[model samples]
Target: LSLTLYALPYTLAERIAGPWSGALAGALGSGGAFFLFFANTTDYIPVLLFSFVGILLGFTLAWWRPVIFYPFIIIWNFLLFRLDERRAPAQTPHLLHRHSAFWDEFQRLPLVGLDTHLLLVMERNRQEAEAAMAYLNTTRQRWAARAAQIEQDARQLMACHSIAAIGEAYHRLSTSEATDSASALLRSFSRISQDVDAAMRQESAYNRRLALSAVEDRLDGLLRELTRSNDRYAARFRPIAAHWREVVADVVQQLAEEAEMRQEIDNPYIIGVPLTEKQEIFVGRSDISSHIEQLLLDRRRPPLLLYGQRRVGKTSLLNNLGRLLPSTIVPLFVDLQGPVSQARDHAGFWYNMARSMIRSAQRQRDLILPPLARDALAADPFTGFDEWLDQVETVLGEHLALLMLDEFEVLDMAFARGRLDADGVLGMLRHVIQHRPRWKVLLAGSHTLDEFQRWASYLINVQVVHISYLREEEARQLIECPVEGFALRYEPEATARVLALTRGHPFLVQLLCAEVVALKNEQPAEERRLARLVDVETAVPRALDHGSFFFADIAQNQVDLTEAEVLRLLARQGEETAVPRQVLVDYFPSLMALENALIRLQKRELIERIGDGYRFQVELIRRWFARQPA
Candidate 1:
């Protein structure tokens, strides 16, 4: 292709100018011709040879004046093309579109002629083209008018809600001496923000015309205005929102002064109160509760397993259950990390349980477990635990006890000898499950319960509840709750982008929202304005870099492996859409250890599985790795 374009000047010069001009043109054009021959030749020999020839030729021309080179070639080409044209055959010029058999015609005739027949024909075609353009213009105008009318109607419908009232709060800040007044107005607007939102959604849904482009744009605009208004309202009132919360609580207390607070349903669903900015807590475990109730609530001897990947809220679920259970149900929550080093026997489990039970009893203000805690500490931690359990059962007479151990897989005997196959703890759990009538064991870990069952063999009738990723609607609701303060909203594409990036992980979702909130904080007053509570732009790559989150512990872990090899492998495979297992094995010879390392890395969510291999879990990390010097 380069040669074709390169030869054109020489060919034209030879046809019109003369041989001397064609030679000068060809010599001048040799630089481009060199590129064609030198294509893809990066090897040392090829590069060295080309460099030698170029240098030798350039030195040979040291005596010639380089400045006159361009003009001399141009003059020479002018004579060559004139000479070449004379030798060429006479033919009518025409543009042709090649097909297998049939040829295509050009709208503009190529043959030059000065006659009434051709002139009249060309004039008629020009008129037809102008008429088509005029018709298109008329159609466009009609569509524009219809769109404008739809927008007007949609805006009017939007105005019927409190969105405009809330939006007014944002505009109020532009004026001086109205900041406090704006805050007050924003508070007033917050009281009915959701009501206004519900109304807008109803209006948007019922109006079929909103599906049209004009109406849809109008609807979106109004929605955004409302969101910005609410965000402004939040920003204005944030300092006082906590105080407002106390005031609301005081009011609720006053209303229920005569009633029992515990019996009454407190506002668990944060529908009206704006969730505090930067306040993070694990909430909403209805599924976890339901599974617990079905498998362990009424059972006499239940061996229940609650398994999910690390940080999937397995511990949170158990804590929620502990809060909800009655005093009659003795629930002991234990962090199982201690057992691997200290819990060599049943004595360890008992001692660990005693302290855990004391904490729970203290939280509940129950005096029933005080003596048991003290008595258990005096004996071996294991013997003390068994004695305390018996004493508690004797005191409470007929109550049931629920022992919840978190990260229970750490107790595996395999992990004890620097492996993960622990059958001893599983046997102890099985013994408790079979022998105890009023005791139920709830074991939670990052791995599946079947892993424990395989080792124990005696863990019969144990119910396994698998905690999976949240459904789309659940994740959206979770995100929507936190962003209400920002009044930022996400377009559907933006929502999907966040979900895809985080893979609907709860902690990851919170991290993304925090980043967006930080972005909003850094913007200037004019730039800070937004239409939605969780807009995509605030979460886009330009909005934030999540690479730091992925590579956070890289410095810490670099000492464990060859930093260069680990980084190189990750840099290559992590950015890949998918990496083969063999590629990883080849990259890291100690792949068995590397696999374990990768698992630990996955728990941190620095990478995610793509079919058989993995990809960087964060986009910024992928891009960063891609740009690294090889």
Candidate 2:
């Protein structure tokens, strides 16, 4: 009973530790029971004391592992006289050694390495952990540039006001998306790509306008599908397309209905937007037109250089040249800003010029040539442009052609970039003038005459007409004359305030007038005018939406940070005379630092030189710049 008590405690303690520990406990408990069976009945208390002490000793040795549980068990039986070994001097065999044979049974049991098994399991789990980490690291994000492009495409869709422009825009977007894997929406969008492409591919159709009309229904469905798609890109940009879809559809429908009767109509109060031949609302610039006509009538018909500040009606002047010039002069206007920008070489420049010249002629006058003549002109028209012009001259015998190349500054930059051949293009212009006497060229830019020194030799004989801001009378006509057709009127003081703000600049006058008119329109029809000077004054500050202006062309594209600071300071001055150049230099560390920036701003027409001072050339620009956050 005493040995049983001793073995019970040790067995419970060792079993709680480990499998190996539990085996040692069992050995101890069994050894104690054997000792109890053989122990003397007369000295039970002494025998129980020895059993407890001996079982504890065996358990301590067995726990160390170096003694090993099996070895401890064998030693235990010997010490207790339980084993019948050949060397044992005991008279009878031990009960455990002979009858129990527990050690023999334990040896027959299979061996296992629990520590090694645990390491293998841990290694497998590590592989699963690494895979989970890799899955978490993977991303389905589209790049920022791709999102920007989609936004750009959406804006283009909104701006495409023409029938052909809409079809062309859709086709271009689809073609771009085929190469673009920006998002899953774009990838899935290719399903109807063939339909969009074939519909927009107007060249393949027999009747161009009719083919476009047929595709309108299909295009509407496609746009709806685009709006319904569930994608991050769609979520970002689909709303922009959807918002404008109705407006765009209305415009397309109108253009389609009046395709035959449509004529270019000029809005008298057009601001930032250039006027076109379709518009007849020319408010001023009679003086500039007279000067250009006189220049064209000169013996040589020398190139006329028209230079002005940004948004000062340079494009409007070019657009109205056909109507302004004598019918005999046959004024031809070509906006080479886009083509010249994309021009790669002299050939490309000539090709762009020839194509524009041909297109303008077709649009203005239904000038037609024989198919053979057209074919000859089409083949290498860049080099054979003079020949084509000679052919055109023959077709319209004695017809004087005044080719007006608007936005010539872009062409100038093209030459500087080495994308256009300096000698070849300039020489071509000089040669065309020398050879083709009837073809009169008008070169207009926002830059000063000195900026044109790069092509000085070609323009040596050209007449430079410096465009000035409108006179007060002309500015008044723009503000008050538009009211005649629409039954609107302006207060005398309102006109005076407009003259004060705009400084008779054409674009600013248009913008200020448009703002006042928009506010007046919101009121009752009778109240829709600048009759209330108070109302006009109040709306001036709120009417200027920064998004409506093309400040990006100035802020990001043209000026550097230093030049922008010069503008900001000038803006703060608010209609005051320009700050002195020396004072501006003081703001900078040195004169040399601001010299390039000043020149750049001067070239872009953002700021102008006035005596020893410099100021923003445009009045509204000053107002806009002042509003920008520091």
Candidate 3:
């Protein structure tokens, strides 16, 4: 029972042990060694007749006081050692064992590595010497042989004079103390040598140009021969190049097919097809909806501004809000895309509103809107605007119409270009909101609020809400939702890569996912499974290369691969404090377009302005960019 209890504690201890468990085991062994040396020695031992008790004493006292048990082993060891020394030396002879110095050295071996410093120094020196020698050989070969021969002859003639002077000077020095005239002879030899050197240098220069011309003539002949040979060879292999071209063309077509498969939404505003299963509803401006909802719930209206960059989804949000309004309230969805003439014709807007009301009211004809909308539509298109609006108020109560005007800022742009009567249009809209307190007006557009602030009287009546991109967490979940499978979730690394690359841009995210799914056959096994996968790597960057396919349509006609290369460079510039601008220009001269593209990207919310530059909104997009092979 006691053993069982002690065993239980040890088992429990083992189950809960952490990093300290190994140290604990080592400590127990060391304590036991000391206990064995001290225990059952000296005072506890009885006098043996012939042989002492052979039985081990630890079995019955295994659970006894540890402190007393430890001291007994210590005394026992001391007495045994004392007894052994006093005994015959034959019983305790030293044993022989082989020592292995090689084994010891092997066990103490250093980690493996080549001598990097020596290798680098040798490589650099070899490269420098090779380059210098190649340059010297090229220069020597380019010189005229005839001129060089003349220079060599001149040097030989000069060398004989130098030798004769040295011999004379040696004889003069040995014979007697050098005379003052000896210096004069030496000076004359130096002048003669200088004259010879200058003549040789001139000859050498002339020979170089002649030799270069001759080399060029030989090179030109060789080039012509090589070109003829290549042309013949190419003619022989014409069918093979054609076959390779066909294969490449098939691969490109497959990529396009893959893109079409991945694109989810087939809409004009969305730049690309959706590749993932995530739903992308462009809610451009929620402030208008929230304010409208507030008015319907609390019976109050506040002016609103729906401002964003072009194609930023502002118009879509208002359409959604109009759909959400109750049937009792007439929802008029208006498009201001037409010319100012259409806008100024109040009767056309009223006619369109009547048509929308008729369509909705057809569901409940007995609700009184049917007859009223019918009567409005039956009226002439050129009917007085004031009379039509008054008739509309009489038909549907003053508080019934939810007038949603999309692209209101188009008028501002039109007026700036002198395409519209701005005062008349403003006066008309201002009159509708001010006179009809019951009517709720929602104005939306893809312009900044500052651009349309001039319409204060009309805007002051509604609330403005800025609808932005999905939060990082939301975007990540949305991106991975399509690929999440029973076998594995998206690996953090793979998901991070996707997010990092797309930067949470809705269209881009979907487009990228579509491409990825096309590659993976839409199979989701493990998150980071794509870490080993290859990406779609083909893109024509004509803008980066001057006169490329893309730049021909642009303003300066300077197309390039700069945008593509910049993306790659930026991804590799991870954690860098700053990257020099010249690095970009040196590699791809179209870097100036990057700033313009970045601004456009921001407007579309592909990237966010942080400080000096931008970061991907979706980290996975950045990670995906990082995973792309250079």
Candidate 4:
């Protein structure tokens, strides 16, 4: 009966165990009982047999893995299967991993790319040198003739006082392609030309003509700076000219290797599209939506300021606000890029706003305005718009009208340009909010709260909410959740690398993951189940270059010249630290210019005013800014 009892457990365990596990279980069960049977006859025998068993049991018990493996073998097998699946197929590679050492040496790049960037600079300079050498070898005289033309124009501009002759000289200098660094050198000449043009055009200035004559000394000083200093390129870079081919060859080799590596990845990840809006790929912005929801639920219904850097998921949040907010408030997406952008003045704004509000209210709530009032809004919106808003309020008594003005910077731009009356528009909105407590404005822009108040003065009453980068956990969700459907995963290490590289910037997180997924598709089908370390190393550079296309215009279009120069100066240094106030002051020289540039950069959220100096709020922007060519 005791044997039967022991045999019953062994049979049940074997039924659930795999082939090897079942055999081991059967052996242990039968052998243990047999040994015990003999041991029962002698205390020393039992002690001798159980001594080793006890030791092993004690060790194995602490591990719990081999002992616990019985129930979790399926999970273990799954992991093994995935690991085996990612192993590269046995074949000769197109590029024999030569760049592995290159990557090893430069692995700290992207984080501290300033030194590595010198390689690119040197390579570019050498290529220019080679081209110049080729041109001199091909037609030395024609190049010399153009050089003479540039020199003659430079001399004439310094001494010649005629404005017409100055314009011609500037034009000649602008259109030249002489010398080794002619392309970079002309930028200085161009700025001087612009300064001369502005000075000559100054109608009110008393010393305009004298200021224009200063172009002579300006041209002389600039020529010295360019020819002597070699502005953006190295004048004596020829020492490393022989080693230049290695840098170009390295990138080329990496590209070829990447192409081969990609051939193994199928259906790689794609970017240039948002994730959360797609619903299937939506991820963690609960950090944002949760606060917005609670704010919406509040009875105050005060105006909101949704501020973030460009492309930080502000539009996505706007699209999702209605779904995430409580049912008490109605969110009508007021896209200024929509028909509302055509508003040129206060009257036009009222007309366009009424059209949008009526259309949105009807579609969202199936509530239609009376035909008479709708006609009144379309014809004379300046007066009837207020009445129609009252009717909308009557239709939904307790429900609030949460007006989300996206890209509200458009109005600020229009106000700055004098096309829209800022006081009139701001006053109208303020009056509406004051009378109708449930009617609140939710304004979002690439600018800041101080800017809104500066433009309107009435916006001082509004509440501002700054949207920063996603949290690490949220960023992880963005990286992992979307790829779940493809039965693909970024290996935990690769995921951490992504989080570290992007630093929880949402757009960057999405963009990098998308590049990773696309790069992943190039791998052999069998090897694409998980993103590996090499895959991350390969994808980062490509992703950075690709994503920078979106940011290339930020400095050009967003800030003025002095602001851009300050930003560039900061970027050139790389990394964030407490820079002395004097450093920036020296960069700008003028106190007013320095203060204006810093303020605009702050309002744009490009950098922050922390401590005595400032640092980039988004490290990725700093990385991007650092990579920019001088």
Give the TM-score of each candidate.
0.43, 0.55, 0.38, 0.51
Q: What Cα-based lDDT does every candidate model obtain?
A: 0.48, 0.60, 0.41, 0.58
Candidate closer to the true structure by TM-score (higher is better), 2 or 3: 2
User: Between 1 and 4, whose TM-score is larger?
Assistant: 4
TM-score leaderboard ranking: 2, 4, 1, 3
User: Candidate 1 — worst ten consecutive residues by lDDT sum?
Assistant: 95-104
Q: Which candidate is the best by lDDT?
A: 2
lDDT of 4 at 56: 44
* Better candidate number, 2 or 4, judged by lDDT: 2
Task: Tell me the number of clashing residue pairs for each predicted model.
Answer: 37, 5, 59, 13
lDDT of 1 by residue, 1-630 (tens): 434433565577767886445544544454445655677767656645554554344333323423335354334433443443343233222111011001111111211111221222223343432333333235322332222222332233234333334223233221221224343343333432333333233211211111122222333443455446655444433333333333323433443452233222111122111222112334465676666766666545667778665545666566656555555666666766664335444544555556566545533434446344334445454445555567766765677777777776556643455433245445556766777777788878766555555644766666777765566666776655542333445556766766776666565555565555446545654544342434544454542355343334443442255433444466665334666666777877786777776775565555667787766665544545455566
TM-score of decoy 4? 0.51
- Show model 4 residue runs off by greater than 4 Å: 1-278, 296-301, 344-348, 358-375, 416-420, 453-455, 483-486, 573-604, 608-619
Give lDDT tens digits, candidate 2, residues 1-630: 544544675568655885456555655665577576866577677666766676665565434443345455545544433222333433332232221122233232112221222222223343432332233224221122233345444555556554445445545452331223233343223322333344344321212333334344545665576667764465654554454344445644655556324321212355556765544345678898998878877887577789886777888878777767676776667787777458665555565666667656654665643222334435564456666666777866777887777887777777777787767777877776777778788887776556578677776677888786888888888877842454457778888878877778777777777667556656765455335678657766764672245655667766778888888888887775798988898888867769988888777667889999988876666777888887
Candidate 1, residue 615: the lDDT equals 66
